[model samples]
Target: MPTTNQYEGIKHIARITTNFEDTCEHCKEHFIDPATATNHYIKEHGYKILYIGPESDISGMEHYHWTVTILGK
Candidate 1:
């Protein structure tokens, strides 16, 4: 068992894009898709996806992006 404080400083946000250049703010890794980026945080970093933000347009890039909030112990 772990206390709430154990998870402090372990929450992070990952930005995933549909243009095959996804980025994870915690690990600083790039992925090709949202699934890969999410899985990387879960599997490799032992983090759980807490929230998936709504898709947002990337201005003139013509592609959309979203944020994935994750937390770990």
Candidate 2:
């Protein structure tokens, strides 16, 4: 069986979901892909990566990052 623990090292997270889910505040257009939208996000959307991932879900690489994107976005 797999175990789930609440306490972990990557608890810090920046809630940048609204931006990924919705359009840019100024232009008003949808994000192509929230998971790999860093380029689009930073360039077209003018978003800064204030936080460098290591988000709460320490389950795995894709799982951790994607969970935030799907649920949050």
Candidate 3:
């Protein structure tokens, strides 16, 4: 079985937002929606979407933002 440590450094992440300007963490490109940001990482950055959920840091605020965590190749 694969160990957790083996995957420790293989994760990449990006942030998508509805209220603020969304920037692609990997390529510094701007996206309008979460889907576009997510697709950018997958198709252009060679990353697979592992999890997408509300960013805990900004949770419970008025704005809606999502953190897209991906597995890198």
Q: How many backbone clashes does candidate 2 have?
A: 0
Q: If the candidates were sorted by their TM-score against the true structure, best first, what order would they fall in?
A: 3, 1, 2
| Backbone clashes in model 2, listed as residue pairs | none
TM-score, candidate 1, is 0.47
What C-alpha lDDT does candidate 3 achieve relative to the native structure? 0.61
Q: Clashes per prediction?
A: 0, 0, 0
Per-residue lDDT of model 2, residues 17-38, tens digit only: 4223644444655565555444
lDDT of 2 at 31: 63
lDDT over C-alpha atoms for residue 28 of model 1: 75
- Candidate 1 yields a Cα-based lDDT of 0.62
**Model 1, span 1-73: residue lDDT tens:** 8657544575454444454576677667767777777678788877765555665676686776655444453
Number of the candidate with higher lDDT, 2 or 3: 3
Task: Quote each prediction's TM-score.
Answer: 0.47, 0.34, 0.51
Which lDDT tens digits does candidate 3 get at residues 35-57? 77767878888776555555635
Q: What is the lDDT of residue 60 in candidate 1?
A: 83
Which of 1 and 3 is ahead in lDDT? Answer: 1
**Runs with alpha carbons beyond 4 Å of true place in candidate 2:** 1-15, 18-20, 52-73
Q: How displaced is residue 11 in candidate 2, in Å?
A: 25
